[model samples]
Target chain A: MAKPKIATTSLAGCFGCHMSLLDIDERILELVELVEFDKSPVDDIKNFTGRCAIGLVEGGCCNEHNVDVLREFRRHCDILISVGDCATMGGIPALRNTVPLRECLDEAFVNGPSVHNPDGKYPDDPEIPLILDKVYPAHEVVKIDYFLPGCPPTADTLWEALVALLNDKPVELPYQLVKYD
Target chain B: MSQSVMFMIDGVQVEGRAGQSILEAAGEAGVYIPRLCYKEGLSPHGSCRVCTVMVNGRPMSACTSPISLGMIVENDSPRVAQLRRDLIEMLFVAGNHFCMFCEKSGDCELQALAYRFGITAPKYPYMFPKREVDASHPDIFIDRNRCILCGRCVRASKELDGKNVFQFVGRSAEKRIAVNGEALADTDAAVTDAAADACPVGAILKKGVGYVVPVGKREYDDKPIGSDIEAKRPAAGS
Candidate 1:
């Protein structure tokens, strides 16, 4: 029988969670033997080829594209796990939640001291994804099966949760595995 | 000498003085009753409700309720645990608690409680209310975003420091911690005051010194909150 497939993505994140997942080191060999990668940066798969057993989302929804990608993952995967502080609680991106969108855009594109914009206009193009008014956690956008709360949710945390889910067991993380920072 | 009172906590008999609260007696008996507003050496405010325990099947704040003779207390029951978890979750969502970057992440009682409860993320939606950061004070800062309004500072300032430098302002959702004067800098708050050290979250922090303790060496990193109190328990089979 074919092994269960896992999908992963980084939305509005710094890709630290993916780095931590890779931090599993030689265990990656064991993981590949247990499950197949689908629609993940791990295999450079741009899109889903088939349904996934689990979806590991690494960030929150900060733009229309993020929402679209998260919704796509929700539809394609049987189980969705938020795999970091960013995916679970919006992380550093949500710091802009208090600031007005206009002010943030102006400060970034129009008035920042380091910015060099001759036209003094915000980035507006048909191809560019529109930014959302506020960043939202993955669960706020789509139903999340589980949440691994950490800055990058240590490699052990991701590995343990995936192993438990793959074996149809409960994902009961020990005290050391769960951390916010 | 005060008369000794015996009560049953989680069906285990425990003895305390007649005037002791359930929380105080529980602490002495080596049963860690989690609390925030009720700090040792300070008067119990009973405001946080994290220490709510079942007193003869009725919910009461263990920090404020005195233990009567033959009283039955339930501290670690599933129902009470869930209640505490709910309260912690509400506190998280109600405040803009960015735990990832909080200076008091490891040492914070609020964060430690959340960690102890295994709360990956709060179940409720984030309020994300716009709050202020008062950096006006040269020696200290008040980040309202992380404040849980537990009133620890209020009690500490008035009862311990005798400064009355902090107090609650507004009502209901608008409620927040306010300095005695127009700003914290205008007030007589000093970094050495017990009020400065009383905050359970990152709301109140001393300036110039942060992240001093490394990640692994910080308080509540290897052990859970209330471990110190639980460590005081008598050895089993004694």
Candidate 2:
């Protein structure tokens, strides 16, 4: 049987979840044997080549580009998994949910101690992704089939979930394997 | 000393002294009933209902409900566990618990209970309510965003420290922990006080001492909370 195709991405996150995926260490060799990588930073594939069996999204929707990428994954993948606290519950980025967007932007771009905006300008570049009013977990924007909650889910958790999904077995998570941070 | 009272918890016989709660007796028997807001050596407020169990076929807070002679308690059941998970989920959404950036992430009892209940994500909608972070104290910081309102700090201050520096202000959704005075610095509260350490969440944290424990080495890293209680501690003179 052909190996299952897996695509992964990090949107408003620190890319720590991807780091934990790689923390699987030598198990990456076994992972390769079980599933094929597609549209993932691991393979440096910029776009999805075909339909993927699973999509691992690591982060919440913080901007227009994040929503675009997340919706695109939902459209192209058979199963979508929110793979970290950010994707699951907006994590640290969602802290801005409490503050107004205009205030946050002003603080960051205009009145910040290090900012030298003599022109009193804010980012209005056409190329920059428009920031959303509030950071939202992936499930809030797009349907998420599963969620592995952690700042970066331990490597063992990622590996176990992947192994179970690939083999058509139930994901049996141990107490120590699950954490928020 | 009071005579021991015998009880059955989930079909296992456990014994405790008169006036002891079911939760305390269960702990002595090496049983863990998932709970928050019920710290030992403090008054039981029965605030967080994570430790809800079936006492004689009726749901009751194990921490606040006293165990009587021959009382039957059901600690672990699908219904009980689901109740716990639901309570935990409520706490998660009610508070802006951004665990990744929290100073008390790994060491937090609330987070640990969530992990124990296998909660991947709360089923409730995120409130994301605007909260305050009071950094006025020279040695402590109170981030209302992470407070679960368990009243552990309130009890610790009034009962243990004898300072009565903390109290609950407001009501319902507006309820929150508050230092008695204008600022925590002006109050009798100190960083070394038991109240600071009594917080189950990251609401009250000691300043200048964040993340000293590495990400994976903090409390509840390799084991679940209350692991010590269930470790079959040796009896006296063993």
Would candidate 1 be rated incorrect, acceptable, medium or high by CAPRI criteria?
high
**Which has the greatest TM-score?**
1
Q: Estimate, for each residue in A1-181, the C-alpha lDDT of model 1 and write its tens digit.
A: 9999999999988899999999999999999999999999999999999999999999999999999999999999999999999999899999999999999999999999999999999989979999999999999999999999898889999999999999999999998889999
Candidate 2 chain B: 10-residue stretch with minimal lDDT: B229-238
lDDT of 2 by residue, B1-238 (tens): 8889999988877888888888887888788888889999998988898889999999999999988998999988899988988999999999899887788988999888887777899888899998888898899889999999999999999999999999999999999888889978779888889998998889999989899999779998888787888787445355
Report lDDT per candidate. Answer: 0.94, 0.90
TM-score of 1: 0.97
TM-score: model 2 vs. ground truth: 0.92
After TM-score superposition, the amount by which residue B88's alpha carbon in candidate 1 deviates from its true location, in angstroms, is: 0.2
**Model 2 stretches with alpha carbons more than 4 Å out:** A114-127, B233-238
- Fnat for every candidate: 0.82, 0.90
Chain B TM-scores of the candidates: 0.98, 0.95
Q: Which stretches of candidate 1 lie over 4 Å from their true place?
A: A116-120
Q: Per-residue CA lDDT of candidate 2, range A1-181, in tens? A: 7888999999989999999999999999999988999999999999999999999999999999999999999999998999999999998898899999999998999988998898888878999999999999999999998889887898999999989888888877888888887
Output the lDDT of residue B30, model 1.
Answer: 97
